[model samples]
Target: MSQTSNSSSRLSALLLAAMACAVSPAVVSAQSADSATAPGLPATPTPNATINLIRLMVERGLLPAADAAKLVEQAETEATQARAAITAAAQPAPVAPPPLEPDTVRVTYIPANVKRQMIEEIRSDVMAEAVAENWAAPRTFPEWVAKYKFFGDVRFRYEGDFYPDGGVPGGTIDFNRINTAAPVDYFSSTSTAQPPSYNADQTRERFRFRARLGSEIDLADNFTSGLRIATGESSSPVSQNQSFGASGGNFSKYALWLDRVFLKYEIQPKAGSSFSAIIGRTENPFFATSMIWSNDLGFDGLVLQGKRKVGENLTPFFTLGALPVFNTSLNFGTDSTASSGGGKAYASQDKWLYAAQTGVIWNINNDLTLKAAIALYEFQNVEGEVSAPIDATTLNTTSGFIGSTDSSRPGFAQKGNTYIALRELTNSTLPGAGNFQYFGLATPFRELAATARLDYNHFEPFQVSLIGEVVTNLAFNSGDIASNGPTQLPGPRNNNSFSGDYEGGNVGWNVNLQVGAVALQKAWDWTAGLGYRYVESDAVVDGFADSDFGGGGTNLQGYTVSGNLALSQNVWMGVRWMSANSIAGDTFKADVLQIDLNAKF
Candidate 1:
């Protein structure tokens, strides 16, 4: 290992030397001048403070002193001659003028055809080399091991709570005063006001591993297939405890799942337009994703997509498809033994989902970027019934809506009065030989959504971004929308009265300051930010309490402060604190501390 390491270091230095020589413009400029002064003399490098680097390296035994001195002497000689020639050429000169009664003007314009020919030649050479290197040609195998690329990240974390909550309260104050000011007593034992489930003990530890493998292969002149296998964890909307349900974490386990698998055949069936029909599972191509670069909102189905780039900065993208939607809530649940009758119940449906999204990217300026997209996504339940039985008097299924034909229906009616679902009786698994199923007429029930994202990064030392999204279900426009369908599955005692409509929106703002690293180049590179988010869910079910409305409450507003500190070029640590208050004065607070080390192999 040591021998290999030493050899690698030597190779790195060789490459650095080559790069330094290539861009040594100062030395080159002096050599060019010296060439004019003494035509037959060999050009030399210019003397500069940077050249001292070579001398220092030689002294430290990092470089050959003999070679370094020879190069330095040649450089100085060239610089001196160049300086002399330039000085001699600067001597005073006299100018004479002539007058003429008429003159004929002539001009020559070189055709860009010459430039095009030169570029084409260079391009052909590059292509030849790429083909020889097996870099440009598609792999021979469609599977097994085509051309694959892999990437991922790892993180380490450390957390310290000095005050155990708010860092000791900032001044001389009584313990009673501090307790009253923050109201931690009513919310939690820790001053942070976080749920006991999220504490992770005094100092928490968390690790994440994300990796993706992608490859593409050609089947014909215009047909190709591609696939991606990725493993990663994503945050969920539902509470962690409820979301994971014993998968072992509020955070789901990482598993190898297909992010995309599609086959495409180009259609030249035009002059200025073209199209491609893609079949299989792939990104829905709708919605704006910030945390995940690839399509976070992917669906399984067929898509007919088309693209046209009128100019360098303007392009239009369109896609339409009938996709399959997996119930994220149910998909992440842990019911491993439920099939054996020992875990939480599950609900699922059997129905085809669909979605469509069309958007355009308009580059108005170099520094400013803008995009607009409109999308429609529908979630359909496939299974018409839930077979999982919880116990006697209870049917364990995946969810309440999963076992029935009208799984997507919001609520039921009881005694001429509508009430939201009391519970899903089908989540429990029954003593059965087959999985439960549901069926329903395919409906184009759509969620109309729009988003606007502006990235203003050209302003220089600081980068700013503003993003916003708004979505609403057009079918359920009214405040008291109700589902006029069967209330429950076949059961001994049928008691169903559930009806409610929930509509909500969120707005948030963030500001950041990038601190300079020039002052403390190694120990302190950082960015500090402050953010605020306001969310409100209106017209909740009449029975559910406000505190249980959304993730936090019916109406939520939070203030957060965070920063990242760099301990090295490849490693950094981050911390964030958030304090949120419900409309009813309830508080939900969180603190996160994390460290990350990143390097490429």
Candidate 2:
């Protein structure tokens, strides 16, 4: 049915071919020749669309102009007959039915091969637009922006502190305050002032909350960066729970602190396991429990970490780090060693902690696994330094006042660690001569620790795990601590001196058994566990240990029981109870209860 066209109609044929080729591959314009398409879309099943389809075949030289014209004519006739058939099927025609529809996709010049190719091209275009305007996680953003991911969590807790009924009220020394702020005057004959007292044997309750927001960005290489901010009542490194409004006013806004900022890089060798390095403040690089490193503590400085896969069921890992504990002040002796212009210069006494750990993960079978590690952490220049004897008669005429090693004093400390005074006053005659003073840790801290965990999943959806860790402070020596200046224990001080007995110990350990759902996910799924702990006076630095057991610190013995229930995805609630008592100091004990609601993204 092809009629050859002469030169007279060749102009028309060329024009039709040009228009058909110029149309977008995805869309036939909504304003096609007769505007034969659905509202707001350029799709298939339209008269002009059919004609364009035939002309495109001619333009691609798949069919001649005459044959394309013949096809178009036949397609129009079929469409007209199809409409008449539809009208007759309905006893009384409503009105002229819409010929073009968003749902109709059939091409009138339908041949099997051509229809398949045309459908593929149009589907490709539709998919591109759908992804760009996707309802969830739109993909139209820049490639670099797509590499970023954000996550965070918020927790609200109600904590109750119950003190023993028979305990006394005010003998505990508030050394933490003295170390960070001012010291009590002890040298003046007329001065009856004493160190600030801690709140011992007091029952209390408070509402606290912890909030954190962070972002992780993946760079082009195998490098990544993380940044986070959190709420904290103070600048303490081990606690991030900000208390609810208890100030003079109600509903006060709180402060946010920089909690984590770090850069990490990793590389997978072509034939071996992966290796990595991290810098700045980030999560602790070593695997440890709260008895060794608190859940909220962040490690700062440089750390190197690696894991080697030995076999299908065995992997060995190691970590090493050097961290700065304290940096010396520039103008440390200004007041005591003052001149007409400014304070005197002092020697630098910075402190550092060097740590290392090696461990392995052993998967014995489908139902059992074991993980174990041994670690060493040594604190350098962390011991207290006593100042030179001061001459009583020359109090006002001294050229230098502060000690050379005063900067070695810990800017922050917790309970259970033995301490000594930094000043060695020679019976000053002046009034209030001991107004400025400081204290330092009596023992250098070098902890050696061994830990292990065994997990069994014999019960289908539940797991049974046995966990244990033992730690000893290798540097803690009662003789060395007592030989220094007057000692300060956790409780009351006796005549500002040591009792001459072995007053402190170096070892601590904890073990726990748990049974519950492997992980929290759906409603009513629950988990419960119980554990016991015993920490000697100097076993581990109390500053970085768990803050919830016995009001936070060491020289404590305790047992903990906890239970959690999942309410929905990314949300859960937990209840915990801890009963703790002092291991061997003045009588002290407490029972703590905490109920928490947590959510994460």
RMSD for each of the candidates? 31.4, 18.5
Which portions of model 1 show Cα errors greater than 4 Å? 1-205, 218-222, 232-259, 265-276, 290-297, 311-313, 326-349, 381-445, 460-463, 477-595, 598-601
Q: How many clashes in each candidate?
A: 42, 0
- Least well predicted 10-residue stretch by lDDT in candidate 2: 487-496
The lDDT, on a scale of 0 to 1, for candidate 1 is 0.42
Q: List the residue pairs that clash in candidate 2.
A: none
Query: Per-residue lDDT of 134-209 in model 2, one digit per residue for the tens?
Result: 6434546767777888999999999999987754455446578877764445435656776675567767899999
Cα error, residue 45 of model 2, in Å, equals 60
Model 1 agreement with the true structure over 85-145: per-residue lDDT tens digits? 6677788787675664477555567689997998999999999898767677675434435
Q: After TM-score superposition, what is the CA distance of residue 221 in candidate 1 from its true location, in Å?
A: 3.2
lDDT of 2: 0.75
Q: How does residue 361 of candidate 1 score in lDDT?
A: 73
Off by over 4 Å in 2: 1-116, 128-140, 186-189, 246-249, 270-272, 338-342, 391-403, 429-436, 486-502
TM-score of each: 0.43, 0.76
